[model samples]
Target: MQTENVTKYIVNWLKDYASNAKVNGFVVGVSGGIDSAVTSSLCAETGLKVLCIEMPIHQAASHVTRAHEHITQLKERYSNVSDTRVDLTPVFEEFKTEVSLEGKQATVDMALANTRARLRMTTLYYHAGLLGLLVAGTGNKVEDFGVGFYTKYGDGGVDLSPIADLMKSEVYAVGEYLRVPHSIMEAAPSDGLFGDARSDEDQIGASYPELEWAMQMQDEGKSLEDFEGRQKEAFKIYMDYNRRNQHKMIPIPICEIPNKFR
Candidate 1:
């Protein structure tokens, strides 16, 4: 589809969904990254009240800095835009202590990252509930739906996702078309999990283009047998992540008896 048509379609989709759900506005967690920036812009374009919240933890300096710049630009771009800064270090630390994950650095980091996402979700829901608004998810197709690169009840919990069907490359295309900040569009994508220690590519060991290609193949009903060497590896990683995180993508199982119970 054409870029303009896609943008309009997504905007209208969210608007209609929100209206039907009795939501008057949207709350988005803007990480000052391209995905969130694009999602925020689209939400604002729908004439919905867009609340862009910047929730940064101790390890996410670059993300925090970029968030401020994006928020400034968004303020200039949209009259209904509002920004909030929330530091999640204290909450993460307290949660870590309560969970007794003191000496486990990797475990603590994972927990802390999830805590940051959940904290942001909580803040968004708080404002959204008060304003009768929906929480807009910033996840892209390649990450959230394809690879499950999001927290279960954290960033993954949202009332609506404006860009969930778009891949990373498509999202960047929309970001460029929307005139999102160049720095954010060019910056390396990360989960802002471990400061400078890790990034999305570093954790996944494959770039979005490669992963998206594998996803496209899967979408086209092609089998992994068609790929060879590195392509196969990429597909394996994507499939592995999908399999491992299946629980996160679905609702909890419920016990059911048979027709007798009904």
Candidate 2:
């Protein structure tokens, strides 16, 4: 890919979209991950108001540090860029107190993890509404469509997704061109919703490169019978995630009323 050209294209696209929408600018949740770093940079490149928000809920120290570093660098590089931190830990705790925790341990833990993402989403939109800014999404192609790895109506809810068309590797390329902070580029990819250092690879059981390969294979219509050993295992993992999370990738289903009923 022509990294420079692609970066310009995305920046122009963002500028055009925001102009058409008549919004002041964009508000992005910076998670210190490659995607967010790249996204916020792209938004900044548009010379529009870019608000980088840090909403942490029991977040790991590394993630927080990287987020701060990136935001600081962004503000220094782009005059239109600014940042704010909203600690959501207490809010998360209060929410858990009011909800039922009677499910299986794993199930309850997963639900709470998703809750963290939803809380962050709410905070982002709150700022967006207050400032007349659009909520810019930080998701990439693999997480947004290939694996459906993000929380629905949580991080998945957004006013615009600037990098959803770029694959993970492509996103890294754009990040390199944008001069994203080195710490974020080197850190392992994570959702940071669980308040732990567990990488996205750990949760998905497949590294991005491996998943990218599997995604390509699936697109070519290859099946389990076509591979063996590790190849088969990786393919199966990709297929399982894709099938399970189809709801996130597709439009919400609606029950159509019969004309006669009306």
lDDT of 2 at 23: 96
Candidate 2: count the clashes: 0
Every model's TM-score: 0.92, 0.99
Model 2 deviation from the true structure expressed as Cα RMSD, one decimal place: 0.7
Question: lDDT scores for all predictions?
Answer: 0.83, 0.95
Per-residue alpha-carbon lDDT of model 1 for 1-262, expressed as tens digits? 4888899899899889988887778989888678899999999888878888877667567777788888898899889888777777787777767776677788777776777788778888987888788899989998887888998878898987889899898899888888888889988898776556366889988889988987887889877788889988898888888789888777888978899778
- Least well predicted 10-residue stretch by lDDT in candidate 2: 179-188
Model 2 lDDT tens row, 147-246: 9999999999999999999999999999999999899889999999888999999999999998899999999999999999988999999999999999
The lDDT, on a scale of 0 to 1, for candidate 2 is 0.95
Count of backbone clashes, every candidate in sequence: 0, 0
**Off by more than 4 A, model 2:** none
* True-structure lDDT of candidate 1: 0.83
